[model samples]
Target: IQHALSGLGYAAVKGVRQGKFFVLNLDGWGREEAQKQLERISKEVLTNPVIEEYRFEIVD
Candidate 1:
C-alpha cells in the first residue's frame, strides 16, 4: 500500500490502508445504539479480532 502511494509521488506518506466502506441500513436504531451495535459487529464479525484494527463513522 505504501509502495503504491509512494510510486504515485506521495513521498511523505508512511502508511496506506485500504478499508471497507459499508452502508448498513439501520432503519429503527438511533445514532447511539447504531454506533454501539456497529462497534460490536466490527469486533466480532467484521475483522480479525486478534490482529486487525478498524474504525467507524456515523454518516447521515
Candidate 2:
C-alpha cells in the first residue's frame, strides 16, 4: 500500500504502519491512580516492550 501510494504520486508516503486501537472504561478511579495502573498494564500485560508499544488515555 505504501508503494502503491507512492506510485500514485504520494511522495511523502515514506512508510505505513498498522496497529490496534482500544478504548477502556474504568470505574471510580482518580486520574493519578488510573495513569499508574495503565502504565503497569501497558508495560506488563497489554504489550511487549521489545517490539510493541501501547498508550492510554483516561476520560470521565
Candidate maximizing lDDT:
2
Error of 2 at 20 (Å): 0.8
Q: Name the Cα RMSD for model 1.
A: 2.6
**Candidate 1 wrongly placed segments (more than 4 Å):** 1-14
Q: lDDT by residue for model 1 over 1-60, one digit each (tens)?
A: 799889999999997777766667777899999999999998998888788888888888
lDDT of each: 0.85, 0.86
* Model 2 error, position 17 (Å): 1.5
lDDT score, candidate 1, position 3: 91
- What is the number of residue pairs that collide in model 2? 0
